[model samples]
Target: MTLLAGTWDGVYRTTGPRFDAAEQVLDCGRVLRVRQFDAFDGVFAATKSGLYHSTDDGDSWTDLDVPREEVYSVVGSPDGDRLYAGTHPAHLYVSESGEEREDDSRSWRELESFQDLPSREEWYTPRHRNEAHVRSLGAHLDVPERVIAGVEVGGVHVSDDRGETWEERKDGVHDDVHHVLVRGPDHYVASCGGGLYRTRDAGESWTRLDDSLDQTYFREAFAHDGVLYAAAARSSPGTWRGERGADAALFESVDDGDSFDVVEYPGHPEEVVLSWTVGDDTIVAGTNDGGVILRDGGEWVEGGRVEAGVAALCAL
Candidate 1:
């Protein structure tokens, strides 16, 4: 079953080029932040107001009852029966029933604090509702107890009891983390304002890996076929505008996050944001501009472009 995508104003089926704006699945106003669209069971979106779910192939959506609207990220369990939503002003919300929010059976499970990391209220600073956005999330395939959340202003948080309690990993990680990816049993990568960083000790300590990459804005990172890939955008020193400057191509890092090699695309180096590996060899990249590019085999194909821009992409 192929999934659908389009501008924030509309939604489209992946099998065709035509789009139906009537089926604009997600709302942009109430949702201050939206992340993690799982196309298999449904799409999971987090907003500053609350959480939303779209199950009718992105035709419509419902809001999940959450404590706060400042949700940074949403992660689904391997079974797709439940989801873990992380909020800024730091809070963890769990939905045991991963169904439409309209479903009354769904309940919100809030997790208590973990480790000696400062509480969310203690680190309260004025920033965008999304400023403390949960930048990245990953669940261990082999170890079900392990879950990780990368916060923008805060460092990393790990939950071993499936979101029951959280612990902050403050060793070698930068306080400002842009994204995170779990590579293996003992390794993880984080992209930050400083550059690419790797931690062999489960985020306890990190090592900088920016020497091979041109100093640019590291927007997003992901893993595919056991190879690490990061997407970055070249920016002007003053303001972060892609229209006035050239963006960087995608990069591949084979040896964990130590180094990188830029991947070539069809157009001039354009910036790409969120991406996901659909199959063993397919990658779908969502660009800042409302465009989607699919990488199959050794080539890239333009899926479509939306005026409002592409926020995120995931395989169905």
Candidate 2:
């Protein structure tokens, strides 16, 4: 299988079981997300430079011309007719024609309703000069009108009418959300800086799931074949560069979010797993230290390494 790694330097491609031969394909800087949805025909990379689309696997990419250059998150509508992009300044934009339109015809319009959230005034962080970012975006095929957004230092919010209106869902969950993993029409897992949360009623209510673990800061969560996987560091990114490194841990859950068992891997306390994708029969993961590893038959195996820290991954 071919794997794509979105890293701080650029986008890399490798055919693995091993990724020693991974090569840079796109020079876009600081890729935060590399994703492919079943409803969309191409892969998308959200980067500091801009939002890009790759129709020919990871070989080539096209800039989607999002109004803002620092796109942090992207998602497609359930029917693939629309596209949504979230920027570094905590702004939301929607493209009515998606990527199917000609270059000249395609356009993105700002979703001003998102700025009207009740907690908008509190969406700042000292890390980014008191500015926030829309770090994650998600949409479920079962609910086309529903769009969920996770803002870094902001909060988790939902739009039931496809970005036309929004409601705050951050009451029970932490405000520093990093990623929102959509599992069903009304079910989601929010990986936050303070904790990992799950909502069963489309964000109306949430439950913390990381109380049994030592790690409090989470980047992303993945669910496949009834198994849930998550990785987290002891604290935020500022503490990730010390002698002990990230002090990270990887957790596996077979009973949804009820409980978790820490899994041992190569770079235990030094490297944190930042991205995940499924191959033919193995679960592939990318780490902040540029390490690639896979799980086969319940055993973790090393899968070579890339040149730069992998922030996101996609398997095809």
Candidate 3:
């Protein structure tokens, strides 16, 4: 098995139960997401530099030239005909042609209607000098035309027409969204700085899932094999540098978010698990402190270490 770690410095790859000797494969900066979609070929990386595609198992990468240099999120249409790239300024772009096209022939058109959201002017974050970003994008095969977007400091929004027009869904959820995990056409889990939220009617409403837990600042949520996993810090990243470090905890839900049970891992309280992927029969988690952990024999154990903090992960 091969594991790809997207970090602040670049992208690294390792084929082992340990990542101590992981090698850098791509130099794209601040990789926010490394994912693979059944509708699309190869692996996609969303980075501060741009969007990249790797076909030969992370051996080489090709820039998709998304126009915007800082791509925070990328997703493919359910039909695999279109590719979406969300940028730092909260702009959305779509490529009708897949990334397999040549660089000179590939084109991406801005989804201008995205700026027409009624709350567009309010999508600013003080951390980014009043600039916000589209931190998460999600699409489900059950709803081919529906596209869900979670914006940092902005809110959650849905576009039924596939990025052409949008409806505000963040009314009941916190605006400091980090990731949106889609389980079905109407089911989604939003990880935000304020709380973790769940929606059943396609984001028309949301319920907080972490009211009983101490950790509130969630970065991402993942669901696999009927199990839900979420890791969160006590507060925002600003408080992650103190003596307690991130003070983070990992939560698991087997009953689909109705309740959660805190699970212990190798790096508890200090190193937050920032990314997750599945390799073979093992569940893999990467941490902000460069720790690689695996779930073996139904328990979390230390697997290895990478050179830099892993922001995203993909297993092939």
Candidate 4:
């Protein structure tokens, strides 16, 4: 499924050039984030217009009840007991039915304490509005008690008690977090506007891995079997209004983001690669220029374009 970012075409599930509507109706707005939790057998999408839920994979989706008008990130607990939604202006809302379901039966409760994190007054976006937004949310597979929220221009906020309390994580490090991928209790990667960072001590310290690449603007990243894949551009998306578009470079780190080398593809994304999905033996990348490239058998292949820009892609 492709979460269209450039227009209100909403989300679509595609098989090569053929595609089908995945949302309830038209003009569902641009989807900023899409997450799938196997524990719940569900998929959630945070869009500019509203939030959505899908139970039977990507076949259908319905708008879920949310208080905010713009949501940036959505993630579920490891046990599927609770669902978390992060929205614009950096607000966090949670719902818990103690059981996972397909509909909006769970009661959502806002966690106002999230705004109390450190240096919140310093959070400001340079290109757009001054206020920050929660762009990425993550949870450890083994350690269910620990969760994290990556707020753009606001640094990282971690909760050890499942979002009951929060603490800011940043020291001698850059913020503007774009995405966070938590693998285990101690291993995680933060794809930030500054560069790619990885923490082995659970956010205690982050080591910048892009000092050599010189491509610091990182948006999307994923790690599997100790191999890390990331999308890097010269700058952020908000500043990409030039006629030249963007210069996105794909990189792979064999040592868990300690170092990276460029990877070539068929339709090398001249724009930013903002979405990534890993299949059984394939890895797919979606670019800001509405390009979808797949890597299988060590060769890159152009799948197709969504025409509305691909922000998020997941195997359903």
Top candidate (lDDT): 3
TM-score of 4: 0.90
Clashing pairs in 3: none
Error of 1 at 253 (Å): 2.5
Candidate 1 deviation (Cα RMSD): 4.0
TM-score of each: 0.80, 0.97, 0.97, 0.90
Tens digits of per-residue lDDT for model 4, 1-316? 3332222357766543212333322256787876788777667778888778777656666777767879889888888777888888878999885533456445578887887776888878756477888899899778887778888888877888989898877664577888988877877788888888888777888888888885789987887666888878788776565665566688887877777779887545466778877655467777776677777666667766665777887665
Per model, how many backbone clashes are there? 4, 0, 0, 0
lDDT of 1 by residue, 1-316 (tens): 3444533443334543322222345654333234443423566565555666666656666676777766657777665556777776666767775444446325777765632356453333355454455656777566566788877667777777777777778567666666677776457788775567788877777787776677556656788776777876654223435475555667877877667877776443754554443533467666655566667666667655555555455444
RMSD in Å for all candidates: 4.0, 1.4, 1.3, 3.0
Model 3: per-residue lDDT, tens digit, 13-51?
998766878999999778999999898789999999999
Flag regions of model 3 displaced more than 4 Å. 98-101
- Candidate 2 stretches with Cα past 4 Å from truth are 98-101
Q: Which stretches of candidate 1 lie over 4 Å from their true place?
A: 6-13, 16-23, 30-40, 79-82, 97-105, 114-116, 119-131, 235-238, 242-246, 266-270, 279-281
Q: List the residue pairs that clash in candidate 1.
A: 48-69, 114-166, 290-306, 290-309
User: What lDDT would each prediction earn against the true structure?
Assistant: 0.61, 0.90, 0.91, 0.74
User: For model 4, which pairs clash?
Assistant: none
